[model samples]
Target: MNIALVTGSGGLIGSEAVSFFADKFDLIIGIDNNMRQYFFGPEASTQWNQDRLASDFATYEHHTADIREVSQLEPIFQKYGTDIKLVLHTAAQPSHDWAAREPFTDFGVNAVGTLNMLEMTRLHAPQAVFVFTSTNKVYGDNPNFLPLIETETRWEIDTNHPYYKNGIDEYMSLDHTKHSVFGASKVAADIMVQEYGRYFGMNTGVFRGGCLTGPNHSGAQLHGFLSYLMKCAITGTQYTIFGYKGKQVRDNIHSWDLVNMFWHFYQNPRPGEVYNAGGGRYANCSMLEAMALCEEISGNKMNYQYSETNRSGDHIWYISDLSRFKEHYPTWDWTYDLRSTMTQIHDSMIERLAVTQ
Candidate 1:
């Protein structure tokens, strides 16, 4: 039986993976403990998404297991063994701000949790295609050092820079900058994932994502940039923009689009290959630009405040260069652009809010 195992199975990306691969894989095994709630409070809890998955897909077997606990993960891997064909490790302490509050917890989840998964995969389903959802933070503040031009509403790379047309690529250095507590832990996990694949000759692909967003995301103040911003717009909650004069930019990729990249990679396995994945130029926006789009879509003038201080290790401007991933999987391309994606988030939030109300 072809089984797919998804860690953080209730998250924006993990749940998307389950839904996307439900028809393709025989059984979908999920491990998520709703750690997001702990990381960003009750509003960020993914339990609702978990419940939705259970209701939607019978083939999806849910486990409220913490990836940080090796004992909790071992039995699941052992039970399925080689039958598990795809291991999607998406669980992590996602916010750098929160990471500073507890460095041990952050390292335990992001770095140690990844090590556990890799070791388990190595011992059990050595042949399974392991896909890790790494972060752009791995590049640290290195991207900030680039020659960036500030526009009226957004920050853009210099037109003459090689990264202007496409965006930042994997070749960007991952060193000598403030990575924050969260980025440091992710870098540890990121490099380890690569090492496992290269050293073990296991098929592992690392995708460094920008802002991964969707309706399913349990948007919070600390993370889930677009989702939270949209939520605030719909609910009349005041949103805060930090530093770079709210011109900080990020590429936002829909969850389905990213999971599709995982599907393409799983179809044709590559060992230790890393790809920068995001909306690219096709679906990117600055903070101010995104706020405007949210207001446009929700028809609500968002209550927002700007802060002079920026989040530590935050990118002033970043858009993933899809050239490498596209070159590798020419068959795959982005289906959701920025406007459409935000519209989906707006509509979905409205439906969900109505239900709750």
Candidate 2:
């Protein structure tokens, strides 16, 4: 029974990864303060998730503490994580739209919070395989570089580029005007995670992910892209469709696949590697495409209207060039496609929302 610790265990990604590893690990420890709600306020959905996990995962124990406080974190690391074998760090302030309100808060958590985790791991779980979830926003607004053709449903790169055959790759530049405060913090963290592995010889790995959505997500207008859309469509919540023609693109990956990468790398333990984790460009879709699926499934037209004000650090298109991960993790692939995926999330949101709140 390997002991596993996840920092942002209450979040959409963290909860999914926790569910995936619960049966396998001896005892899984989840650390989160649910403080994001303070930022997102009433719109934040994590409280429902925390309540559900407390009920469902009996073997899991959660601690309500901010990672920024070393005193709050050190004891936990000293206990279950003293020699913890795997650390899957899914914690971060992920809203590009919301980051501007407090750049320092975002930096404190995404950047300094990560440094705290790494330093603590160095002290207690030095040999532990550490996995960090980074965002595709690290590449900034890349799809802006491409010539996009808009369809009624979605947007795609021009047919001329050979690599557009797949989508954006790891080679795309991180330096661009599109990066918001969230992107800047994440970029800083992503570089440090890699640097810690290189400089300190830690078993560190980074995942620059596209949209990672699932049923556990506390979907809100600020984050949780797919689940938020599903909630709005099924539950009659209003949503905003920002610029880029609502044709801005994204490739949604299930949380299970993202965790599988961590699970595999944890067991085998990679030394400081970065991979783009997503459903690949093959599963790519635009906001219109996603809402169309939601509308089709729930039989409700989304109560969404387009806005000319493009959100900062928002990408017009940024699909994962997931070939790197696919070639390495041959045993792993997408278990859920767009339609069924949306359906499962919608049904779960209905069931869980009814039961929890």
Candidate 3:
């Protein structure tokens, strides 16, 4: 039986992977312990998405297991053995603020948990393509050092800077910056994923994602930027804009587009290859711009307040340069732009809220 293993199976990206690859793999094994609840709160629980996955796909097999525990993770890998064709490692303690509250949990989940997955693959399915959804936080606050010009609504790179035309690329240095506890842990895992591929000659790829968002996300104030922003807009929740005069920018990539990129890499099987994944020049926005867009789409005025202190290590302006990934996989292109993505999230949130009410 061909098995595709997805960690964080109930997450925004993981659920997308399960849906996208269900037909390709004979069995989809998902490993998740609903730790989002542990990391954030009861409201951030992903049990809802897990139930949806179980109901929606016949081939999907859900395992409530934490990636940090090797024993719990190994049995599944042993069961599938060589039939495990793909491993999508998306499970993470994904918030910088939350990480400070519990550094051990953050490092254990983000760094050690990744090691467990990598070793399991190496032992049971050496040839399986391992895709890690790493974050641009792996670059830390390095991007903030770029020459930037602040406009009325957003921060823009200086016209003369090399990154101005396409935004930050993989070539940017990953050192000498404040990475936050969350970013630091991700850096450890990111390098390990690369080493597993290059040193051990396994098929592994790291996607340094900017703002990976979709309707499926259990959006919380700590993470899931676009989804949470739209939720606030729809629910009339007071959203706080921290730092950069609320003009900090980020590139947003829909879950479908990112998972499609994974599919391409899985098919081609690149080893130790890294790519900066985001909406690129196609879809990006500042906090102020995103708020306006959400209001326009939801037809509700966003309740927001500005705070002078920005989150530590947050980027002022970050648009991913997809040139490397595009050059490698020319067939892949974005299907959802900013407006479409926000609209979809708005609709999904409305449907979900309606169900609960």
Candidate 4:
């Protein structure tokens, strides 16, 4: 049977993968232990999304297993054996602040857990295309060192810089920087994913994602920036901005767009290829800009405050350059821009809140 195994199957990207690949794969196996609750708290639990996927897709099989434990993971790999045609590793301890609170858990989940998945795929499903959801944090604070010009609402690269038009790319250095504990762990996993492809000759692809978000995200203050910001706007909760004059910038990509990229890559099968994935010049905004957009969509003023301290290793200006990926996959183009993305998030947040109430 053709099967696809998705770790963190309840997450924004993982859930998207499940739906996107449901028709392509004969069976969709999802392994998640609701570890988002363990990392962020009960409110951040992804059990809701898990249930939704189980109900929505007849082919989906849910497995409550942690990627960190080999015992829990091995049985599934052995069960599927060579039938697993695709393995999407999207589960991660995804917050820098939370990582500082529990370094061991962060490293274990982000680094060692990735190794576990890679090894399992190597042993049982060596032919499967392994796609890892790596973060731009793999570049750490390196992007902050770029020549930037601060405007009233956002920070932009110097107009004269080559990156001004397209934004940062994979050519940027990934060394001698302050990668937070979370980023450090991701770096380990990112390199390992690449190495597995290069050394083992496994069909692996590493995507260094910008702000990955969608309605499905279990939005929390520690992560899922866009989704959480919109939630605060809709709920009238006080949102806090930490440093950079609330002008720090990020490129945002909807989960569908990203997972679609995965589908293209899975079809082509690249080994050890790393791509910088984000909205690029098509969809990017600053904290202040995002707040204004949220208010416009939700018709509620964002209650917000600013703190002088920023998160460790946070980027002041980061817009991904998708030239490499685009050059490779010319057929792929962004379908959701910033406004459309925020609008969808706004509607989704309203529905989710109403359901809970």
Query: How badly does each model clash, as a count of residue pairs?
Result: 0, 0, 0, 0
Per-residue C-alpha lDDT of model 3 across residues 1-357, encoded as one tens digit per residue: 788999999999999999999899999999989999988787688999999999999999999998999999989988889999999999999999999999999999999999999999999999999999999999989888888899999999999998888888998888988999999999999999999999999999999999999889999999999999999999999999999999899999999999999999999978999999999999999999999999999999999998999999999999999999999999999999999999999999899999989
Write one digit per residue (lDDT tens) for candidate 2, span 140-162.
77657778777677777778975
Give the alpha-carbon lDDT of every model: 0.94, 0.83, 0.94, 0.94
Residues 200-314, candidate 4: write the lDDT tens digits.
9999999999999888888988988999999999988899999999999999999999999999999998899999999989999999999999999999999998999999899
Model 2 Cα shift for residue 231 (angstroms): 1.1
User: Residue 355 in model 2: shift from native, Å?
Assistant: 3.2
In model 4, which runs have C-alpha deviations exceeding 4 angstroms? Answer: none
TM-score of every prediction relative to native? 0.99, 0.95, 0.99, 0.99
Segments in model 1 whose C-alpha atoms lie over 4 Å from true places: none
Provide the lDDT at 43 for model 1: 86
Name model 3 segments beyond 4 Å from true: none
* Candidate 3 Cα lDDT to native: 0.94
TM-score of 4: 0.99
